[model samples]
Target: MIRRFITRQLRQPLPPARPESDPYARALPKGDLSGGRPAVVRVDGATKQALETGRTRLLVAAVSFTLAFTLIGWRLVDLGLMADQHEPSLARSLSSDALETGRADIVDRNGIVLATTMPTASLYANTQHIRNPQRAAERLAEALPDLSPAHLRAKLASGRSFVWLQRNLTPRQQDRVNRLGIPGLYFQREQRRFYPHGALLPHVVGFTDVDNQGLAGIEQSFDDVLRASAKPLQLSIDLRVQHVLAQELAGAMTEFRAIGAAGVVMDARSGEVLAMVSLPTYDPEKPAAAPADARFNRASLGIYEMGSVFKLFTTAMALDEGIVDLNDGYDVRQPIRVARFTIRDYHPKNRWLSIPEILMYSSNIGTVHMAMDAGTPRQKEFLGRLGLLQPAGVELSEVGQPLVPSPWREINTMTISYGHGLAVSPLQLTSAVAAMINGGTEARATLLKQDPAGAGKGRRVVAAATSEKMRRLMRLVVVKGTGRKANTAGYVVGGKTGTADKPSGGGYARNSRIASFVGAFPMDDPRYVVFAMVDEPKPTKETFGYATGGWVAAPIAGRLIERIGPLLGVAPRGDDNELIEQMLVDIETNAEGRQLASN
Candidate 1:
């Protein structure tokens, strides 16, 4: 009976269970609307899995965006505040080859490009792949006229894996070579150092090797710095002033028939080198072909006994150390004799000359007496303090070491005081002179630009009072002394003339002399130091066969100061009454030792 009942229930189709009770049935579409109950939509297992994955992806994207923004913000902060000690990022980015590997540029203080690198293509050949070597050589020679056809042929036929046809090729040249349709002739990317000013700043900017390596001048002194840095090296040189100085120096060289010449213009207050010139200079583009003499930097590398320019230092030492006063006088009646040497003045005044007279006339005997009073120890210390006893501390590798007497004997001191027995470069002399007159502040020569505020913090080398006296004395020299030729209108030019016989055969040559003149303008408020020097200048008809400093170099200084004054914005002062009257001193005395003005 139970078997029969189970069979009947299964056959009735289990009376169709309700859709609300079946979870799987809720996801199916309703077939008819007759049921009155609303259909419920349920999420399937696959849809739930897809939604979970989407949420995970969105969270990851949000985290990544947050990290990216944080990194960008951190980098900005680092550049603005943390990188203050680093080089200027903007300057580094502006270099011609800053996008690739290249040396930094060298610019003048005024942002004029002195030395730079340009994009170039170097021609190289894979000899094995080159067909018809002679044809390739002939075609290449046509493109590069400077390259010899025979030389290029030999290089292509060398059977080597690679060979260089040319180091630097211009865009036109590269395009011409490409038109030849020669296989194995290819261009390798390269950079070539270029000096836009050419010979204008060869000595200071210097040249590079075939591989663009620094070999001399500021280049050698700061090679690693240039290679690693992207910013330009801004030198203290002003291109405008440099051009004027070079032009004048070249004219003097030709006029005087000088073997060589040098000139320097420096700021007395800041020790900044406004202009430096050495002739004959070579074109930096072809330094290898230039003569050896043209490569020499006479301003900083050639040491010489600077003649009466040394007297400036001697007089300053005496005044600063209290060994002598302006009123003191020395008997210059005869030439001094000491150990087979006779110290004679170029323009001797045969009488008891006052200190001002001795300096103005450049008396050797009076200078010797002043040195003896200061003693040898004091003389050595004074010169050492002025940075004259050692190599000049400039920004060049070719600085000259001063020739000093090892014994430091009394004769040495006396001779050195009168501008002999000691040899120093023109750069050293200019630096010392700047210090002596710039309110006695130590003026350090440098090639790099200096900050205006930081320039005045150097050590005090001499008393300000002593410096005032020196300014007056130098002005007297230009107005009524050997430096008369250096006096320019409205400039109040003040300076000293120096003429030293060149050393030959263990003695000074009577004929060959090094003539130099160093001057400062607007003596009421000294601004610039202008120096000119001529080596082995021959006498000219204009000077009546005189190659002395007064005839040769003094006039150059005067003309240079006049041209540069307006450019430097130094206003001309017409009235000199107050300055002249204040710096005046009694030139002679009466029997009662009272001061008296000389006519």
Candidate 2:
């Protein structure tokens, strides 16, 4: 009976087989099971919820990854292609060859290097990568003794992407740093402006800051030119002449016990400055450590009452204007009182003096008389023509403008005739004197190596004949009068000696004086103008207890001329006595002729 019942139930079309419940399956469509396919199973609520959550999470993760990659790609493009627009200064600093080709070298006329830029390793760091700040600082401090460990630790601990560890590291220092092998440490290429001669040309070649910006002298004046070109900037300076001038000036400064000294050697024909020196100079490598006074450029910047040097201009003016001849005489026996000012001679001859004698003796009284004859307007015009009334046209920026009397009074003219009342730099005085003796052409002093083809035939300042007479008169001074100490044996020297009291409290300080000598050698045809000045020189035993220009500066000029004559290719002659005798004869004849005319 049971078997018959079971068979009947089994055969009864099985109330449609029910599908089993599964955790991951869902219900199928109504017709999906008609072709003997497996029935779809139903899924539990927790399992379905988990699957949806996983799908949402996967979508979010994919979108996030795609956005991150896009942003990274855009940033790479910006840094690679458009970095200059976004970060110009950083882009410039990161260039591999920036410092190597930034500035040009500076050389003298003979191709001697004065100033140059050298490659150096500068230490920097990515502080974020530093594992231990204290350890890195201690290790770096050993390599760079000048750097403070405390400061280094502070910089390293700052968490900055870029931190300056040190600038301009020496090769030894760089090697020591590399040996440390610390993470985050880096080296960047940089440049340092170097002066091979150090203090030898501190004032002329000047110095630059850490970033290589020029601050003074030719460096300051030609900053743009130096940075724009790779070719060296050539100056008209002769290093050999510079060395000689510096040695002589330093010796004079020490011997005379002077507070300061200045010297200039210039080419009379081309107005090129071969040498310029100022004592109490400092090292260009360490400019900040030097005193302000040591950095002062006395040759071109410091203006002083140039004393008797002005007499050369006065004599030239009088002779050029036809206002006075070589025979013209002035009665300098007594002091002239003009408006409470007594103009007296430092070396009073107490007699009438001729024009040539006026310059030979450095006679302030005779020079005043000469200037009076020429008149104030003519004197100003004449000196202006000689370039004494304006700033010197040198390449340096330290040039001083001449201090002229604003009222233009008669006494002003008298004092100016003897190189008082008016103040000018040594450079200006040297240049003006060059004009007087250089065939009376206006000497526009320059610091550049002049091209012969482009060099201007300078404007005429005085007649050639007048300039010849002035040259003869200057020679007479070195041969017989105040400049006798400067009369070298073979080289014919011509110059004027000046000793002016320092101006103090609206009056002259009789004790303090500026002793100076401005001279030209081989006077037959002058080639160079040599000027030496000792500021506030004290009397020394060797100087016979006298600190006048003749005693203090004349010897320096003589020694300089003797040494540089051969170096400058100026052949020394046998004897200058014949030339001196001829000048004496001319002076005597002119005096006798003037006496006859008066009689």
lDDT of 2 by residue, 52-152 (tens): 77778889999999999999999999989996686766655744354345578899998999999888989999999999999999988988899999999
Question: Each model's C-alpha lDDT?
Answer: 0.86, 0.86
Per residue, candidate 1 scores C-alpha lDDT tens digits across 366-435 of 9899989999888999998888998888899988989999888888999899788899998999988899
Per-prediction TM-score: 0.82, 0.81
Model 1: C-alpha RMSD to truth?
10.3
After superposition, the stretches of candidate 1 with alpha carbons farther than 4 Å from their true spots are 1-100, 575-585, 588-599
* Residue 375 displacement in candidate 2 (angstroms): 1.0
Give model 2's TM-score versus the native structure. 0.81
